[model samples]
Target: MDDLLAQFVIEAAELTQQAAEDLLALDCEPGNRARLDSAFRAIHTLKGSVGLFDLAPMQGALHSAEDLLDLAIKDNVELDPTRIDPILAVLEWIDRCVQHLQRVGTLPPTAEDEGAKLVLWLASGRAVTPAPSPVAGGTLPQWAAKLFDANPAIHRNGAVALRYTPAPECFFSGDDPISLMAGVPELVFARISTRENWRDPAEFDPFRSNLIFEAISMAKRADIEAIFRLIPDQIAIAHDATTDPSELPAESHETTTRTIRVDLARIDDIVGLVGELLTAKNGMSALVTQAQLLDGGLALSRNVAALQQDIGRLVAQLQRAATDVRMVPLGDTLRRLSRLVREISGQTGKPLQLVVTGGEIEADKTIVDGLYEPLLHIIRNAVDHGIEPEEQRQIAGKPAKGTISVSARQVGHRIELAVGDDGRGIELGHIRSTALARGLISAEAAAALGESDCLELLFAPGFSTSETVSDLSGRGVGMDAVRSSVRRLGGKVTISSAVGTGTTIVLSLPTSFAMSRVILVTVAGEQYGVPMESIAETVRIPASAITQVRSNEAFALRDRTIPILRLGDIVGSGAPGRSEEMLLVLEIGASALGLVVDGIGERFETLLRPPAGLLRAVRGILGTTVLGDGRIIMVLDLEALLA
Candidate 1:
């Protein structure tokens, strides 16, 4: 990606997101001039930027979209809810094309045809076309039936249908029939077929040009004719054209300093360097220890320690600045998702209102970027499965329009995002039955489970209460996928539902993955770190306090029996028994576990580098970090270790 193309990709994505958002808003408040203007500007700016590259298809499609919006703004055409479909479709198409351009260095081969359809639709004022006749009549030709069947969206309002049959030897005369049809103005749809009767495979010729081209365009007859001027004697055109039926408060703004855009990769590099500096700072502890053994040790060590403290303060400041630089508000993700919500609502024919709050909460860029897909799957399921139909809702004493709320908040060093829907909540009985039918659990187990346990079944792989599959969801992938995605980012997902009320899925994740707070512990003289967040508390009990429970050792803490495990044994480094037991009480979800260690060390915050080399395959190791004594220790992924 050259600098120009890279810049184009970024700008194109931003512009498309903005345009889609504005268009969605315009769809609801068709009378809002502000949103209308913003959408038009976004499309216009996008069109101009697209012209800089060899993306005529995208450029033309965007141009047509711009014209349509311009008509709405000038009151030449009413911007109804349905009329915005073509513009939205065009934006989505452009976004897809832009992604392909960024990844493959060129537009897709079908771009021209797709763009033409969008252009024609826009030209027709995006009218809702009637269903094609069941039988071919005098007005509808047999060829058009096939064309309409293949491209159902081809607008018939004021549409010109053209059929072209080039001479058999036309291919040898430097003529391209497909390219000619692509050049037709306002071309909506086209089809290619063999001009003559079928021939056997053994007798087929390699090249003879026995093909016919049929297309539907919104352009006038003369414009369509000009496209095939050289082969006028070989084409027929028909006209079936008909007349087509075609936000908020201002917040006070204070002047702020100008800002410059910086590439994310550069910031990541700075963060990496900062982590190295932290490691170097930790290495100084060894120097301080060594200096204590010198002749004037006491005084020398004190001075060096003082210097180390000063560097530590500066390092802390640097870490704060770097982390802040990586922080991005959740609003960006939510705004992008707003488009998906609207699209789902339209497709399902279930009116929906998206309510979002606490978008100002910021988190690491990695978390924000990875959050999109999981949230997408959840929202799709919410609409397709959770939300009921209009009649059902009305009968259930609920509003005709469903509401999906996405809210974010900061709790301690973590961020919690909740996606809730006011719809038909998950039925625990249904989940139990599905689990049994799928052979995920035995009838006895399902019968013994409680509400909370039954709810957990929703996250099980291939678990779904939906009886039928739709494009949006079903086949049991949605919730399971959400759980997997959230877990990959070191997050926890939980679901809560009330019969006849609604359902809410909450995701709890760390604010940043670059740094972590862990309590150092030693197992068989090998130092390790456990995330402090997972530790409920540290406890020391007499060896006699442990009791054997069936096949596992257990301990009593706060009147609750918690399983106790030797960390050394779990890590394959068993240690000898001691008079007293040292334990780190870990709270994972609703279960408590006591992890036995040799000794407890200091609690420290440090940059955590992901496991690499041989440690990458280690299941219980979350990452690795440098200790103050200059030794590298593995950080335990308590969840994975315990599981």
Candidate 2:
């Protein structure tokens, strides 16, 4: 029963989100009947599902919403723009109820009243009026009145009256209808009767279920619904609201497939096991290397090396398969943003269009989940501060409607997600002035800063260019939070803007948080790991091949000069070697830099563990990993090192 309830919560949450997406889409493409049908179906299914839990309030609200949608479907009434808010309000209420149930194991005390108000408002297509009071000594059934009179507390709080009629062939469906009603929480009254007149003893079919079960329960409507969720079509629920809500009509299905729902903890366990397997594989590789070094001419050593290679291949395949299970397409997150854009656009009275591309790119589930808030902040900022008002946009020779383009794509081993707008770009001068005024940067420093450096000030804590605080922006926190979040994910955030064109913020993040492919390099006497994705090329250059430009050393590659920094000096490992040094070219945004190392080692994939203790605050080190030879290798953060 707990598992069933959990599943219901998950399904209901998804349905609500889908309904919101479909409704928003239907509003945009009013002629798209498919979207309209989808919206209706989502609400209809939600209504049916809520009925099983005996959540009177939720069922009533959804039932009214489903009816309205049904009417719209039948009468071909274009969804009135006014109706959208109420429809969304209904979904929001359901979401809240589900959350409440999840937290406290039952709906809130006001759920029934709140649901009734929303339903009344929806049904009237306007504000809800006060419902008339129920008559004293009302036409209550004898059983109901007796039960209530006996338990005054139940009567005062109200009770859910239930009538359950198991299907004639319900036995074949493995339903024990009597046990279902018997299990109703806080059951106050129960009565059983035959659905039809009794037949001859011999004529009675043992398999046919003719019992009609009725009961009254002090338990909340949601509890009653949950008790009968599996057989919703076989039950009826009534609460003591001013008016009785009707039951959801049942639909029959000829086939059903069972699904094994595994808890997220189980999935995390699998990922952990896979990580251990990767570490073990690394140890095996190191053993093979050691064996070859000790017996280079032995056939057994050669055969063992070949076997290690095959094992490495299989390990890589298994790691990928495990990682893939934890990945989900970005489409779900993008759709949520789409709905957000619509709501914000409506509220701000700015005609805006959200153009999403490459949403099909897959990302780690954990990463994607954490992205919502950061993306929300960016989108809100774009709508509120980036996009100009329609009149202003038209005067600027731009279209009346502004466009916010959100795109995601997998680039090498990193995922690049960019949010850009076709509106007024950020002003560098204003940002510099704001930074200086906020004491984030010195006046002289602000004055001498280039455009890119000035733009970076936007991410400084408590720095904003807005003259006044409004519903959005001016809080001096959004961009800073975005930067912090991306940094925590081992990602970087970059911004590009033109004075009047628009601003684009791009986030580059590793494709997998659990494991990564890295190139091992020996610096001085210590070995370090550099993310393979950051390395553009590796070349061995003679000491004299490097040219000194002023106080900095640089090297020319393909007619372009890149500044070079020695890894040993940067990491404080040791002095640089006089021999020909291996240099790794790293691409950082639009620029490239060269890092001088002692020598390059083989590239391999390894699980990345978070830094511990004092190393957590260390900027240039990403994480630590144990190599096969029991050596701990520090993964270098190329971005931070370059910074």
lDDT tens per residue, model 2, 410-468:
99878999999987999888898788788888988988888776787777678667776
In candidate 1, which residue pairs clash?
A: 158-241, 158-242
After TM-score superposition, what is the CA distance of residue 288 in candidate 1 from its true location, in Å? 3.4
Model 2 error, position 493 (Å): 4.8
**In candidate 2, where is summed lDDT lowest over 10 consecutive residues?**
248-257
Runs of candidate 2 exceeding 4 Å displacement: 1-9, 13-266, 286-298, 338-360, 397-401, 409-416, 426-471, 477-484, 487-501, 508-510, 542-551, 574-581, 612-614
Backbone atom clashes (below 3 Å) for every candidate: 2, 5
Q: How many backbone clashes does candidate 2 have?
A: 5
Q: What would you estimate as the lDDT of candidate 1? A: 0.79
Q: Per-residue lDDT for 1-643 in model 1, tens only?
A: 5545766777877788799999898777778888888989999999988988999999998998888788787875557676588787787678657755754477766687677777777777553343211001114445655665666686665576778888888888888877887789987777778878767889877466788888888776556666775675677654432233120000000000012358988987888778878878877877888999999898888988999899988988898899899888787688778789999989999999999998778888888888998999999999988899999999999999999999999999899999999999988889999999999999999998788878888877778778888888864576778876787677889999988889999999887875778889988878889888789999999999999989899999989989999999889999877889999998765568999999999888888877889988878788888776667888988777766
- List lDDT for all candidates, in order: 0.79, 0.76
